[model samples]
Target: MFIESAGNSLRTIPGSFAVQPTSLQALFSKLPAESLSAGQTLILEGDVATSVFHVVTGSLRIFRILGDGRRVITGFLHAGDILGMSFKSHYIYTAEAITPVTIRRLSRKSFENEIAVSPDLGPAVFHQMSDEMAAAQDQMVLLSTKNAEERLCSFLLKELQRTLNAGALQTAVQLPMTRLDIADYLGLTIETVSRTLTKLSSKGVIETAGRHSVKILKRGKLAQMAGDGDEYEDDWRPATPQPERIRH
Candidate 1:
């Protein structure tokens, strides 16, 4: 079923501009699921990245495990977000699931074979890679800032943008991760994170829609607080730096 039409919809995916879905399916057909449980390790630093993954369900975390064994959450993998970054056959970070995950795994040889067979898929994959790199760069800029409130504001703004459509922005976006997760992602203390949200709400930039939800009322103010100048709307950033290199 995955092979039928060779992934017509995959090529059309917003970031997957280069994936020749048909070829991806052809290559993916050779690889199978590893049946990962919740909290399973999918890949780790310094290990050969011999496989690629397409998440079927559940949320996956791509993060760096520090020397002290603390996890720095990089990003979450939902139903989309292809998990493949090939560099000298080694993975820089690791992938684990916040919940039980099912991923379609493809070995490097087979993964590359599909690209070898179909020239179009390579460019498509390259586009997707570039997009991911751009997003990562933006994340670095947010993390690099010394201000925790600024970082938290940026994180919330980004999330809200993701939930918004072109018409009118929603009152709030649903937060999938908890306050601790937000703190970890923003490199802030939980209390600080909570306070930052409170400040934003008090300023009328955002109003609490409900528990685990937020609605934007004064987006312009939120943008100012995030240190992102207000020219673009709907979470558009003036600039997000690209990561020159990410340690695997």
Candidate 2:
């Protein structure tokens, strides 16, 4: 179900935890939406963790800058993804927009208040955090054991799955981040990332749709190369089976 507020909309994906519309409305009504241009920094490392952000549209890159000035990308956040759930007072990574984006900002205090008052919101947050933790563990496996080809294949399949789950019908998966960002996230060099993508396109496993998109052509083969028996299996499932009610 979808909820619309101030010309921006939010929807919960099927097969995932559902937060009641009333809870979401109460939470979001206290927050304001902001628009950001590509390359804009939303939050910086060492900054106070005062608020959390919900991606209403576009994508964000979460990364940490090392002392030597190397940027290590931790993950990518797409539409419906939430960030700033750190238990520490300061953020460890910086969040930057990869494309023109719209985001709703909920202060830490407001979020805690909502969770305390709304029973559904607390469990929904917990489920989302658990899902993120599982994803991080999978990424660790990819970085530690998977080869370059396998890593690229895994990344593509996961992105395709995420796009599909977001209700996108097209085969093209939007890649708003730069090659450097992807390289950092996958623990590969930029050259390796470019070469692997080129190889995949040539092999007909995928096709390049301009600079910022890819279309998967041979999903089964790609999944095999990633060492997964089938297409990317998601661990994210709804905490409850109840139908989501949209609040107008």
Candidate 3:
């Protein structure tokens, strides 16, 4: 009886505990918690948009399926990032919890009602969306870069800084996304990404334990290794050849 009680008390991911926006807090004061397990398909591309989710805990991996049915991981969304952004069209990509997740469910009707009432929310959401777009442009540069090491380094720096800005501590940056997801997102093969990570670890720039655990030890050296260590504008550009356009 005691053990079951303790187990039941475990915190569930995606619960109402994650909702933090001042306006959302007022709306879902009575909202209940729910769970989304890792590797479970939460949504599919083209699924009709009905409800949106507010991640209460855990991480979500966003991926899109190619025509050949291969899943390409676009990015990983951590706690508090909005999942559904499009209303005119359905979800552009599918999202799955990479870890156990909990979320507060918001119906379109409820969200619209709130927006209608609160003029502040619309601008806030738009600002968030614009920020996401700028991040995407950064990724484009990473993707097009020819140097594998440069690309890997850029990815690490960006990933770490992003999480730190989102409430994670600097010394210890948790990689909620899998290495394979990182490789795929950066356009590197799994083996290459693994090798690069091992190299960086051995060189004392980072300390990696297993796949998802990463501790950054030397920030300056890593930025240098990626050619971005120098403050000069020339060093920021990738040293490798440009990627060729793949005709779809």
Candidate 4:
């Protein structure tokens, strides 16, 4: 399932996951659950991919460090997303909890065994991987073609759409990640993000409720600025409410 917003089809939202097969959910429920505080490291880049995690709650930042020690955020994961599904021996990026998080850890060996025997599990994993690739393609376009304001508009609209999926009120979009996190994820500087948002607010396109929330005064205007066309003009809601998709 996917959430369509402003012409972008997002397979999952921040607080919800794609529909898990009943068997899979049961399997996850039987696994051990672990909790981590905010800023805790869940997996490090280059570490052996020994476990796959099912996020039960909270948000995580997926990123990699450059040779010069710069951090590039690949994406953000929320509840219902899975982590450490690498085919390679090591994880490609580091995952850390940006908020307090709970996860169910499944050994890679067990995961592979289940996929081999469970008819539904393999297809679900494949679908998730495909959805991830599509999101990555969207991010590539945003970075290569969009200006700072356009990028911010797209990000904000996407956030609103994600919140809508979790059945939250459409009045305010929640942003759990900080500006620095947004900057890294969007490939812009923190100053640029702040400036662009301020610019939008001046135009009455959106209003910042606080550090962590935004209210859309003009959804169509914001969507237009995002270059997503008039798809958002009709209804502010998705045709079918879908669980959240992964950002990285």
Candidate 5:
């Protein structure tokens, strides 16, 4: 069954697994559950890919350091997301918890053994991999072609969809990641992200519920800015009167 939390909806672990719950549970019953505090490193770059994680709660940030020691955030893994799938022996990027997290760890050998018995598992894994790849490609386009405003808009729209899925079209979405995390992911400076969000707020495209929550007031306009077209116009409604604008 699905439940809403932190402004996003998520399924139970079994449902989220995208496989027969009984089969998945029986296949990895020996694996233990692990917990990490916020900001704790779950997996480091270049570490052996011994196990894959299934997120039961919270989120993780995947990032890498450049030659100059600058951090580049690749993406975030939310509740129900999987991590540590690698073709190589080692992981390419580090993964850390953005919030207190709970995960189920399945060793690679065990995972492979299960797949050997259930050939259908291979296709499910492939589908998950393909979804992640498509998201990566979309990020590439956002970074290469979009301006700061467009990038932020695209990020907000995409995040809403990822977290809320069907409810994303019209809802107040909570951003689990910080502004700095978003700046890193979008390849923009913190100041630029703040500015873009301020501009959006001033224009009544969005309203700030708090530091981390945003009510998308003009989904149609925001969608258009994000290059998603105006098909969302029918769902658009006048925004609530915003508070006095404050310069960041």
Candidate 6:
């Protein structure tokens, strides 16, 4: 009972959520699909948390603006990610489309009511909240301990895993967000992000393809530089070096 819409399956990663997709589809499919062009705001911080959005395609940047006008990007959301999980009345962060995106919206009130009555849905949504917290903890560790180079390396590897999870190539990682977005997310300056990428390229761990894509030339080396060591070494290693190819 998978949630299928527009030829895409909205399935969570195994062990993350025990969702009954048939129920999820029934819960959300009646809602109309929403389309957002790149750079469009999907959810603004401090707005009433009226609904949650399920990403059908493309990417979004989740961030919060500080009182002094600085922005801190909390994370980037890709296909299958959900936003507006706050327990509070107002959203804690803003979600903006980084690429042309398609999503489905479900009112939080309706969602809460349904989950409260549905035994299976209750546990699934709880797991979803736990997953979000784990990701936030990981981001905190990345910012607190990692250097500029390590941060960028870790980011590329993360994007690589996301690419693979989407059933795409293991070596080519697409970065739809701008360097400034990455800088904000990782707590570094845009110049530092550029310089770190350049440094990685010189080391032959990665190569930039056009403005938005990167080819992982040496996964083992990049993972090593990321300092993940055995934690992700096996999962991050590439099967074989393939010819360079860039997607337009």
Computed on alpha carbons, the lDDT of every model, listed in order, comes to 0.60, 0.69, 0.63, 0.73, 0.67, 0.69
Q: Compared with the true structure, what per-residue lDDT tens digits does model 5 show for residues 138-188?
A: 889888988888899998876655544523446687787898999999999
Instruction: Name every residue pair that clashes in candidate 4.
Output: 12-244, 12-245, 13-243, 13-244, 13-245
Predicted model with the maximum lDDT: 4
Q: What tens-digit string does per-residue lDDT give for candidate 2 at 119-222?
A: 77777666666666777799899999999989988998878777766666667888888888889999899999999999999899889988789988877888
In candidate 6, position 63 carries an lDDT of: 81
The positional error of residue 18 in candidate 1, measured at the CA in angstroms, is 19
Top candidate by TM-score: 4
Clash count, predicted structure 6: 0
lDDT of 6 at 244: 15
Please give each candidate's TM-score. 0.72, 0.82, 0.78, 0.86, 0.81, 0.82
Task: For model 6, state the Cα shift of residue 5 in Å.
Answer: 22
Better of 4 and 6 by lDDT: 4
Alpha-carbon error at 42 in model 3, in Å? 1.0
lDDT of 6: 0.69
Please count the clashing residue pairs in each candidate, in the order shown. 12, 1, 7, 5, 0, 0
- For lDDT, candidate 2 versus 4, the one ahead is 4
Query: Compared with the true structure, what per-residue lDDT tens digits does model 1 show for residues 85-152?
Result: 46565677666666766656555565566676677667666666677678889988888864887787
Cα deviation of 154, candidate 6, in Å: 1.0
Q: What is the lDDT of candidate 3?
A: 0.63
TM-score of 6: 0.82
